[model samples]
Target: MVDAYLSLGSNIGERETQLQLAIEQLNMTPGIRVKRVSLIYETKPVGYVDQPDFLNLCVSIETNLPPFQLLQACLEIETRLHRVRKERWGPRTIDIDILLYGKSIIEDEHLSIPHPRMSERAFVMIPLNDIASDVIEPRSNKLIRTLVQPDDSVVKYK
Candidate 1:
């Protein structure tokens, strides 16, 4: 089994509930095992910022699925949650991203492991530090906590 990290976010329809439901779905996936989860944070939205604030958290899982296969599973979970993506980075009921795949550096049309933008987002960094502060970003070779910058602040949701 490989240790993988996934980032979850939601900005629509009971945001925290959406995140919890996503985690539930992930834990139920055949090849995935939910190992650790960080505290949910209320975060300011990024990219297209006109939407509602999001509830975000990071999850660590043990999975036997390949990177692409795992990516497919995440997408499936989002779809199962009735996610509608009419715009780029638009608000959604659930968004699950493959942040790290057992230190694997993957760059493909369908996915990018270590999530190209994870370091720059407080929503990702704060929770990532909670669970995997020692884990390094594959490309940067630096701890995930070290990459955090204070552009945005995140608050504990519970």
Candidate 2:
């Protein structure tokens, strides 16, 4: 099984419930095991600030699925949670991103591993640091702890 990290966020109705449900669903998926989860955090929206603040957390899992398959699984979870991708960075019921997939470097038209923007987002980094601070960026080969953004928006919500 490949170790993977995922970022979960919600900015719309019942945000906390959405996040918790997503975690439960991910755990129920075959070939996927949810191992560790960071405390939920509240952060201002990154790209689009006009929307509501987001509740975010990071989860570590072990999965046997390939990258695309993993992406598909995330998409499925979003769909089930009533996510509507009407606009880029728009408010949603839930958003799940594959932050890292073991040590593999993947670049494809549909998805990219090591999540291209993870290092720059405090929401992603703060929670990630909770579970895997030693994880190395596949492209830069730097430990995640060194790449943590100095933004003050991310804070433990619980």
Candidate 3:
């Protein structure tokens, strides 16, 4: 099995419930085992500022599926949860991103493993650090804890 990290967020109706439901669906998928999950966090929206704040967290999983397959699974989960990708960086019922896929580096028209912005997004970094402090950015080869500033405005919800 390969280790992977996923970042999940919701900014629309029943945000926390959407996150929990997504986790439940992930757990139900065959060949995917939900291992560790960071505490949920409340943070302001990143790109599109006019929407509601987001509830975000990261999950660590051991999966037998390959990177693209895992991405497909995540997309399916989002669709099931009522996600509508009408606008770039817009609010949604659920948004899930593959933050890291073991040590793999993949660049294709559809996906980029070790998500391109994992290092720069506090919502991704904070919860990720909670689960895997020593995790490193594949491209930069720097520990995530070292690359992210500590003062980012992410706070645990529970």
Alpha-carbon RMSD to native, per candidate: 1.2, 0.8, 1.0
Residue runs of model 2 more than 4 Å from their true location after superposition: none
Name the regions of candidate 1 deviating beyond 4 angstroms: 150-152
TM-score of each: 0.95, 0.97, 0.96
- Candidate 1 per-residue C-alpha lDDT over 39-66 given as tens digits, one digit per residue, 9 for 90 to 100: 9889888889999989999999999999
Write model 3 residue lDDT over 9-116, tens digit each, in one string: 999999999999999999999889999999999999977899999999999999999998999999999999999999999999999999899999999999998888
Those runs of model 3 whose alpha carbons end farther than 4 Å from true positions after fitting are none
RMSD of 3: 1.0
Ten-residue segment with the worst summed lDDT in candidate 3? 144-153
Highest-scoring model, lDDT: 2
For model 2, the local distance difference test gives: 0.93
Candidate order, TM-score descending: 2, 3, 1
lDDT by residue for model 2 (1-158), tens: 99999999999999999999999999998888999999899999977789999999999999999989989999999999999999999999999999999999899889998899988889999999989999897889999899987777787889
By how many angstroms RMSD does model 2 differ from the true structure?
Answer: 0.8
Top-TM-score candidate index = 2
